[model samples]
Target: MLRSRDDKKTQRQKSEVWPMAKAHVYQRDHINTDEIIPARYLNTDKEAELAKHCMEDLDAGFVKKAKAGDVIVAGDDFGCGSSREHAVWAIRGAKVQTVIARSFARIFYRNAINCGFYLIESADAVDKIKDGDEIEIDYDAGVIKDETSKTKIQFMPLPDFALEIIRDGGLLDHIMKTSA
Candidate 1:
């Protein structure tokens, strides 16, 4: 059986906007890489393995609780510790592609972009959004809409070049696409 044309139209519309993602709130600031992925678990660079230990030190059940496409809403200095890209990989491997925080460590910010991940810095959004809230982002509009609360928050959109890289799924993919 074929689906209705309306369903196809709806699918196309969803493709234009960011998908609705659940928020996982972490109110504490200065959450370091060590906490995000413990040093003990850094022996391998495998994403799934790393994900198993992501937030193990800080929140032991985070890996078990979080689902793919969920958003992490945290306070200032999120990802403060190591400059390792493993931290970014771990987060992504856990199926969490976006982390909205008050601020992120400079290295972590760069790593996330390089890894084709999203790190949104919005103190106001963090304060307003609670755990388990469903949210959607309008990349072109620079807005985050909380589907649960019917609230909206503005955020600075990534630069064109950065967005391009992220759109291609990392710097390497971007290069490959451009060079092709």
Candidate 2:
């Protein structure tokens, strides 16, 4: 099948690398899914609607402060609690490019990747990165650079399969591409 020029251009746009993102520091641990997106907002799975309330209970100013390419900096045990996919969806819908944490709840980690959301686990980086710091992440290079502090933190690179899934925009899209 041949794609039109516009279709190819659209595909190219989708594959473009993300730019450096700003960080919003939430230096607390054990931030549960419910806190990320309250149960009251759980009535809908619509990302746009859910995004309006993401982190409202925990940080009332989050929605107002968030920008399309902002990153979330959090402490250990981020996204703990119920296995709700809405938690990740809301964050993505808010246009947050990625999340950096000392650690993440196992289920949340997996769910995040499944939704094509980026998450990095590095205890050292989380502590050093201040609120509203500018940061750049190079997944291929496995480096997280804090522009504000002029420091670099290294994290274990994602496995090849995981990277492939992420690059292709989530597990479902990756699977569909391979299947066809």
Candidate 3:
């Protein structure tokens, strides 16, 4: 008896499961920080509070739709606003596992890594993925699989050091863990 390809994949994944994510796509570019958390909500750096308002300005329904281990899919310049760490904080607060975009703002990229948030720049993922699509990301393999569509794409994963920081829960945590 021969198993189908997807069945084979399922069997393999059962042994080495990747993080599963649900895609929450925003079809626009330049989703700035202000829209991510709104400066007015920046008073307290509490992640839980910030989570309540994440993406409120840009998409009022976002908070309602988002869940832990979900993914944000967007076009280029996905964090292209003022240099505000709050942006990444809010996203993390919302329990979003990672973001897939065509590109990212330089500062936001750094801040995200520092915050232990994952961000992948993949044009194919952005273009092919859609809202509500169930996705799985293999960090080691650098692959994004759309479970809904049953397709996948490959991209370069972050370097080992950055992955270490993310795995340790940001630079500060990484430092504390390694230096202790």
Candidate 3's TM-score: 0.84
- Clashes by residue pair, model 2: none
RMSD of 2: 5.1
Off by over 4 Å in 3: 1-20, 176-180
How far out, in Å, is residue 53 in model 1? 1.0
Model 1 accuracy (lDDT, Cα) = 0.80
How many pairs of residues in model 1 come into backbone collision?
A: 0
Q: Higher-lDDT candidate among 2 and 3? A: 3
Task: Please report, in order, the local distance difference test score of every candidate based on alpha carbons.
Answer: 0.80, 0.79, 0.80
Mind giving the per-residue lDDT tens digits that candidate 3 earns over 139-173? 67888899999998898888789888877767887
After superposition, candidate 2 runs with Cα above 4 Å error: 1-20
Q: How does model 3 fare in lDDT?
A: 0.80
> After best superposition, candidate 3 residue 68: deviation in angstroms?
1.7
Per-residue lDDT of 36-77 in model 2, one digit per residue for the tens?
999998878877788899888899889898887788989989
RMSD of 1: 7.5
